[model samples]
Target: MDFKVREVVPHGRNYALLRMMPVKGEMPEVEPGQFVQVEIPNSKSTYLRRPISINWADRREMWLLVRRAGAGTNALCDLPEGSRLSIILPLGRGFDLSVRGNVLLVGGGVGTAPLLMLGKRLVTLGVDVKFLLGARTTSDLLQLELFKQTGETRVTTEDGSMGHRGLVTDHPLLTDGEIDHIACCGPLPMMKAVAAIARSRGISCEVSLENMMACGIGACLCCVEDTVDAGNVCVCKEGPVFNIKRLKW
Candidate 1:
């Protein structure tokens, strides 16, 4: 689908929060934790569309939190309002919303993007939601105010610039609360550690993987993840989100 940029709000030196709307119709239904493949404009070296998580979506607009990690994302962040973008959206599976009881959503760095929508939906469903966010420093944490509005929010920064002075896995909430479910998205090491903690406690956990991808469709086979059930499965199709048990981690 084609979308037009409505606004570009830069979060820091490396991140931009883009608000967009469809060129011709109302926004389609998008599950939280699903992502979009954005075609980079005016970039010669970038071939594949960049995959970005759906930060939030409403009836008329969609938001993408993009990090300027490379040439493609840099170009995407620099796009002006009113620019047109080609996108394949709402791709990949998302976190399970059927969960109930006390739920914790954990994120690190740019991984915090998708949790905003997830928390909002969970709140509407009357599910108790809390967020545990971590970053290298306070500046690395994005959308704290918005996250707080959706649920109880906590923070951990390696630099100790905010909240707790350690990694999120070290947060007291993880060990202290009556957590019924955990959904996490972050660097592999962070997610793995969080999964381990969840495993040891016998709490249900799900994680979103950030595997490399060429095509956003299963046909490309570039984003295959080794899973316990299906061997090598495409993360773009089978999931970007998976239960910890299904993962070979």
Candidate 2:
């Protein structure tokens, strides 16, 4: 389906928060960690559509927090408000929303996009939601005030320009022993470190993988991830979201 760009809000030089609406009907229901395969317009060098996480969604609007990683994303960020974009949405699996009790959401860089909707959904379900957001510097953090509105929010920046002076794993909350479940998305190393902490504490945890995907569906064999039970599976189809137990990590 084609969506019309409603607005583009730039966050410094590397990221843009795009507000879009369906060109025809109301927006479709999108799960927290699901993504959209967006076709970049007027890009000669780009072929495959970029898979972007569903940052947030409502009845009439959808948000995509995009990082300028390459030509495709840079073209997307450069789009005007009225530009039309073709998108295949609600693709891939999302975080399990059945969770309850004390839940902590950890994210880094652009990987933090999906957690906002997850936190909001969990909040509506009466789940106690908390966020541990990490970035390289204070300026790298996105949507702090919005996250605070959804839950108790914390931060960790490598430069110590934000909440805590180290990685998210170094934050004191991880050792507090009060969290029941953890949902994380970030760089592979960060997710692995967070998963290790969760494993040591015996806390249920899930991680969203940022695998390279040429096709958003499983056909391309571009985003395969080796799992404990499934062996190698396509991350774009089987999951962008998976429980720690299922992963070979």
Candidate 3:
């Protein structure tokens, strides 16, 4: 679907919130843990559409929380309202909402984007949701109030600028008691560490990979990850999200 940029709101120092509405057709179904490939217009240097995680989406609008980490994202952040961009959305399978119990959603830095919709989805289904967001400092944390609307929220910062003064894996909640499951998206190291903790406690875990992607679809095998079942699978299709049990690490 082609989406028109409705708003571009900056968040803190490094991130921006982009809100877009479908230009012609109805908005495609968007799921948490799924992403959209955004066409960056007027850029001769960058050819492939950038794959951005779907932050949150409603029937009429789609939200993407973009982190200005490179040239591609910088161009996206500079896009003005009323600009149009082509988007391929709701790709790949989202988190399994079937398992019901206290569930924790963990995100690091801008990785928190997809979890917003995931949290909202879980809340809509009446599941208990807890969010553990980590950043370098408090200023790096994005959209806390929004997450709070759906579930309990917590934070961790390396600089101790807010909440717990340590890594998210060090948060007492993970070891405090029984949590039925965990869904995490973030830096590779953080996701791996969180997965390790979940595995040790025998809690099922799902992780969203942020592997570099050129084509958002499976055709371009650039974003492949070595999995236990499948030797090398495209993270763009087989998953931006996958069960930890299916992963080698």
Candidate 4:
């Protein structure tokens, strides 16, 4: 389907939130944690594509919260409004929404985008969701009020510029036993910490791996991750979201 860039907004210091209008056709039915491969022709060498998480998706339109991490993202950020970009939406498996009990959502840095959308879904389904958003500094934080609208919220920053002076695990949600299910997407170490805490507490938890990719589909072998049960799992095909019990980490 052809998606048109409708609007663009800056998120954090290095990221931008792109709002795109979906074209009429088979709309990509994406879960909260899935992503899309965007084909931008802003540069010559960075051709073919770059993979970006579906950050925040909805029915008619969805927002992509992307940080300008490198060449691909830089090209995307330079796109002007009304530009037509080739994108494959909902290209991968997403978070498991069926287990909608009390959910504690955690995200760090640019990874918090998808969790914001997930929190919204959880609230709509009557599942309680508490958020722990972390960043290195105040400038790294994104979508504060947006997630707050979903449910109760907490925040942490490594430099103590905003919330607690520590990692995301320092947030009350991790130490508090009230959380029923935990869902996380963040830096590897941060996600590991949250996942470990959830495991220790015997709470069901899920983590989305933010792997670098060329194709958002399973065609490329770039996103393969090692697993305990399944030796190799494709983040784009098998899942970007994995249950704590299943992952080797």
Local distance difference test, per candidate? Answer: 0.94, 0.93, 0.89, 0.82
TM-score of predicted structure 3 = 0.97
What is the per-residue lDDT of model 1 for residues 1-249, given as tens digits with 9 covering 90 to 100?
999998999998889999999999898899999999999987899888999999999989999999889999999889999999999988999999999999999999999999999999999999999999999998899999999989899999999999999999999998777899999999999999999999999999999998999898889899999999889999999889999999988
Predicted structure 1: clash tally: 0
Question: In candidate 4, how many Å is residue 5 off?
Answer: 0.6
lDDT of 2 by residue, 1-249 (tens): 999999999988899999999999998889999999999998999998999999999989999999999999999999988999999988999999999899999999888999999999999999999999999998889999999999999999999998999899999897674999999999999999999999999999999998999988889898999999979999999899999999989
Q: Give the TM-score of each candidate.
A: 0.99, 0.98, 0.97, 0.94
Report the lDDT tens digits of candidate 3 across residue range 177-243: 5699999999999999999999999999999997888887899799999999989999999898999
Clashing residue pairs, backbone N/CA/C < 3 A, model 4: none
What would the C-alpha RMSD of candidate 1 be, to one decimal place? 0.7
TM-score leader:
1
Q: What lDDT does model 3 reach?
A: 0.89
Q: Number of clashing residue pairs in every model?
A: 0, 0, 0, 0
Error of 2 at 224 (Å): 0.7
Ranking by lDDT: 1, 2, 3, 4
Candidate 1's TM-score reads 0.99
